[model samples]
Every structure is written in structure tokens, then in C-alpha cells.
Target: MAMMRNITIGQYIPGESVIHRLDPRTKIIATFLYIVLLFLVNTFSGYACSALLILLAVALSRLPIKYILRGIRPLAFIIILTLSLHFFMTEGHVIFQVGFLKVTQEGVVRGLMMVSRLVLLVVGTSILTLTTSPILLTDGIESLLKPLKGLGVPAHELAMMMTIALRFIPTLIEETEKIMKAQMARGADFESGNIFQRAKSLIPILIPLFINAFRRADDLAVAMEARGYRGGEGRTRFRVLRFTYKDVVALIFVAVFVVVVSIYF
Candidate 1:
């Protein structure tokens, strides 16, 4: 059987650690900078430094190591595929050959490096989302994009939409699972069927799912209007976000990590 779809972007866990307490804006900026720095890193030393920083962050967040690794389990196959392609396709003095396919020392090195980069990229960003709440992330995004309001952009509206979408992902997933189970109970065998049969079986689940989704959209619209929701006009937040000393310290640490990694590269 296929594994259940537990892996998602916003797998947040509430906590009171230093990393958890930093403003969401700081985490967003730091994650962006970290990704940029990952590309700048080319040498083993650079990778080592980046790995150390990720580990430090993971430890500080106080989340279980297994949970973090589990989040990346879904990406394992993609990482393997990437490594395989890089290993077999790149041209060099062949270390080994299988018919027309050749493998080289450079290919091996490049493949390993590519896999490592992808793993680090996923795990590091997972840390950001794992610690910060989706609401905080959306709020930070709106605050950061506020300057665009001068250009007639609807920053708050966009952020609100994103927040709602993020909020509903798990709910939708659960709904889908329930629909699938209900169909299964009615002898809708999705697993032991031909392609056409499987497609036909899904129709029952899809129809109800779509109808429910539309109903949810309509209800949300009505609720928003009932609450006097306007498009970012003189809106005030219930929880006013403020940057604290932890944010400053996290930025400083991030800057140092970038500098050290750059030097290593």
C-alpha cells in the first residue's frame, strides 16, 4: 500500500525555545538567505559548516529528530532519482560501464553533492516552518509586503488568502481521506483495478470533495462579509507582532554562517 500523505509544508509544532520565539519575519528572511548561501557553497568544508548550522537550529528548536527526518521521507525517492541521473549521464573518463551507460569519478562526486544539497535544502526549510505558526508566517508576509500597497497591490488580501489556504490544507487532506474510505466501504476497490477502473472509482470521491470544497468557499465568503472584512483598509491585527532580541541574535548567527560558508567555498 502507498504510504499515507503525512508530509506537508506547514508541519508546525508549538514551542517556547529561542528559535521558536523569533519573529516570523526573521525566520523568513533567514531561510531565504540560507538557501542563497547553500548555492554559494561548493566545497566539503562549506557543506560541513551548513550541516552544523542546521543541526544547531534543530537542537535549539527542541523538536524530535525523528519528526524532522520523517518530514523529508517523501523526498527520499526524488533525491535518489536526482543522484542516479547525475551519476549516469555526465561525461568523463569512465570508472565503470553498463553497455552504453558510463559512470565516472566526477559523476559520483557531483551526484553525492547534488543529493546532499537537496537534503539540506529541504531539512533546513522544514525547520523554519516546523517552528513558526502559519498565521505568523502570513502576518509577516503581509507586513513585509506592505510597502507594495503604494503600488496599488493588495498585499494584505493576498496574505489573507494564503493564510486561509495554509489553514485548510490539513482539513482538506482529512476530508479527502474520509471520502476515500467511504468509497472503499462501498466496494470501490482503488487498489486492485485497471487504470480505467481506478479512474472510474475515483469519480464518486471527487464529486463529493469538489462539492464540499465549493460549499466551504461560499461559507467562508459569507463569514468574511459578516465580520465587516474590508480589503486591507485600516485593518488591525488581534495579535500585534513585535520583533524581539532573539530575532536579532538569529540574524547575526545567520550572517556569520553565510560568511563562514562563503570563505570555505
Candidate 2:
């Protein structure tokens, strides 16, 4: 479970950089816009521009390059699988053929494009999560969704749930690690076993995790009720969020990147 040990969500390194200081809502919106534009992109030049923009954002976030790459390590297998499938399945002029496997130029090009798109998308979104704290992100979401309240949506409740879930991801991962270690200490061999046997060994871990999760939920509910927690009725926020000049500048830069990619690529 060494791989699982390093999994993190809502993981942010404290920083005072420009990317870190922007409104969380700005980061969220920019991420969405960037993903949409990435798909609209269809040329190598466009991808290059997008990559450059992503690199610039990552640099501004001031997070270590190793940490960002580590966050993406889990996706390496999927990216390779996608590239392989595209490289073999698409039809075009055959570039290579061996042992009944045919590779085409178009397939190769398409595979590279798809892989690039996935990489850029992951890096772009990870930047937002890596720079902004989960609490702030959820607060931004709730504030943004306030308009939906008119449509009878339980926006505040939904946002609160999301925030709580995000906050607990790291905690749950640590708990899972401890459970795995404890089971291993009791001679529970997860490795060197058949798939079915290994899966059965996980039952001990899963049962406790589920039980504890439910217990925590119940306790939280009781605490909230004791505090007279009503659902979004006149709830006041502790920290009010406001977009700053940095947010405007960021938006402008994103817009320019989009336009340039669209026109030149």
C-alpha cells in the first residue's frame, strides 16, 4: 500500500504566491475554461501554447515540481493504455507492421494528441487543487451556487457536505494506512496471494473503515443539531470572499491564451 500511502486530496502547501492568493472561485472557473479550451484545441501549436500556459501556472503556484509530478504518477498507466489503444486501433497509412500488429501514422499522431490532452488537463486541474485550500474552494462553490437557491436547490447543504468530505480525505487515507498496517502485523498477507485471496484479506480493513465512517457521521449530526444547525437558514460565513486585482489579471491572461490558441492553432 506504499502507493496508497502518498495519495492526497485537498492537499495544499501554504504559500503567498499570486496563484495562491486569487479567489478560489476564479481558480475553479479558470480550470473549467481551460479544460473546455483544451478540447477545442486541434493542432500541435495549440497544445504547445496550452502546455506553456500550464507550466506558467505551475511555476506561479510555487509547488515543488517533484510533488506535482508525484501527484500524476497514478495516471501514468492510464495514459499509456490510452496511447497504446489509439496507436493500434486508428486507421491510416501503415507506419509499421509486426506479428500481425499494424501501426499507422494517423494512429500515432492521434495517440500523442490524446495523451497530451490528458496530461495537460490533469496538470491544469491539479494546480487549482494544489494551490487553493479545500475549505476555500468549497466556500467559493457555495457562494457561487447561492443563485441556485432561488430554484429551491439546497446549495449550502450540498456545499457543506462536499467541504466536509474534502476535509476528511487525508484523514481517511491515514486511517486506511493504519488499518492496513495492523492487519499486516496480524499475518494478513496482502501480497503473494491470488487475486481473490488478496481481495478477501481486505475485508478486515473495509469493515472497520465503513463502521467508523458511519459512526463519525452520526456524531457529526448530533453535534450539529446540538448547535441549532438549521439548513442554510440565515447562516453567516466567518470569512467573506472577494475577488482581487490578481483574479482579474489571471482571467485576462486565460482569455488571451484561449484566443491565441484558437487563432494560431
Candidate 3:
């Protein structure tokens, strides 16, 4: 359950900071550019700059550093696994060996690079979700995809699906936690077990979790229908989105950061 609390994805913290006040579109575009630059850059110095940008943004947002770092804890295993893969597979001068397994100098360098990339990718984009509310995020996505509608894309539906998926992540985690506790009270052993045994023990939990998930989804659909919520066709928003000077400034800042890091260090 503590692991669930550390997940910052799909979670938003309200604040009066400039980061929070910028249009969601600006945040979304900046996040996209940041992610693109992550893959394009090949140097540790570039990753360092990316890390500093995230840190500066976090400070400007008035959010606790620990709060932002919490998001990485849940994905720590994946990061470690990624490092292991790079460290073992890349070929170079042998640095260490164990019973036919060789660790290379190039592998160490590549592994650390991969680890840096993964960490920055997570920390950089997390700022967007931390500062922007789900509703505004959905609107921003839809607005950005609006141009694709002329090319036969279901922009509104696509945005709705993405938003719903993200919005339900916390809900699903809470539901799973609840079911696990309930099962534990009934003497189910989910803890002390080998890998296989632990996975097998989750059967009782997954069954009821899926049922509750589907039931909730159906309930939401019915409620929407009852409220006359048809497709996004001709739909009007209660809160309209507008691009202001703040958004322009935010874009310019991100553009400069991404360009400088991509071309230089």
C-alpha cells in the first residue's frame, strides 16, 4: 500500500505556483519536447541539464522535492533491470567476470547512461501530471489533436480514452489494496511465499478486482448516458481553454532549453 502512495502518475497537487497556472497545453507540449530530447541527446552532460531543469521547475512549483522523488521509487525495479540488461549485453574491454559472464567497460558506461535516461524521463514528465488537473489535461490533449480530426481521427474519443485510463490508475490501486486486505482478513496468504506461490495467491484478489472494475465502468457509462452525455460532437465545455502570454513564455523557455541541450552539452 505504501508503494501505491508513492505513485505520482495520474495524481495532481493543487498550487498557486506559476507552473500550475500555465495552460495545460503548454505543459503537455513541453513534456513531449523534453521526452523527445531525452532520446536525442547522447551525453551525461545533457542528462544533467535535463535533471537540473526538472529540479528548477519543481522548486518553482513550490512542491516538495521528496514528493517528486516519490514517483521514482515505484519504478525503481524497472530502472535496475534496465541497467542490468545494458551492463551485461554491451561488448567492450572486460572489467569483471563471473563464471563465463563478463562485465565490460562499455557496458558500465552504457548501463549508467541508460539509467540516467530512464530517471530523467520519469522525473521530467512527472512535473506535467503533478501540476495539471485531469480535466484540463483532457482538454489540452483534445485541443492539440483537433487538427487530426480532419484526417479521420477520433480526436475527442482518443483523448477521452487516454484521460480515463490515467484517471483510473489510482482508483484501481486503491481497489486492489482494499481487496487484498479483505482477503487477508479471511486468512489468505499473499505474503510469505516463493515467486510462483505469491503470484498464485493473487488469484483470489484478481477475480474480485476485475468484477469491481467492470461494475464501476458500467456504472460510469450509465451515469453519463443518463446525464445526456453523448459523443463529443458539438459538445461545449464549461471551462474554455485559451493561450495567454504565460503559455508563450512557457513554450519559449522549453524551446530554448531543449534546443540548447540537444545541440550543445
lDDT of 3 by residue, 1-265 (tens): 7887777666789899999998999999999999988998989898888888888889899988886898799788998898888888888899999888888999888889988998888888778888998888988989999999999888899878887788788899998999989999999998888999999999999999999889999998999899998989989988889889989988999899999999996
Query: By lDDT, who's the top model here?
Result: 3
User: Which regions of candidate 3 deviate over 4 angstroms?
Assistant: 1-9, 96-99, 162-222
Per-candidate TM vs. native? 0.88, 0.87, 0.79
Which 10-residue span in candidate 1 carries the lowest summed lDDT? 1-10
lDDT of 3: 0.88
Structure candidate 2, residue pairs in collision: none
Which portions of model 2 show Cα errors greater than 4 Å? 1-5, 170-198
lDDT by residue for model 2 (1-265), tens: 6787665666677799989999998899889889988999988878998999889998888889987787678899999999999989988899899877889999999999999998898888888888988889888888889898999888898998998797677778888889988988898887778899889988999999999889988998999899999877787778889888888988888988887787778
Q: Which candidate, 2 or 3, would have the higher TM-score against the true structure?
A: 2
Candidate 1 versus the native: TM-score? Answer: 0.88
Q: Give the root-mean-square deviation of each candidate in angstroms.
A: 2.6, 2.6, 3.6
Model 3: which residue pairs collide?
Answer: none
Query: Number of backbone collisions per candidate, in order?
Result: 0, 0, 0
Residue runs of model 1 more than 4 Å from their true location after superposition? 1-9, 151-153, 177-192
Task: Write the number of the candidate with greater lDDT, choosing between 2 and 3.
Answer: 3
Q: Model 1, 1-265: lDDT tens per residue?
A: 1244654658888999988988999999899888998899887778888898899999999999997898789898998898889889888878999998899878888998988888899999999889999899889889989898899888998998998898787778888899988888887887777899888888998999999999999999899999998777888879888988878988988988897778768
Write down the lDDT of every candidate, Cα atoms only.
0.87, 0.87, 0.88
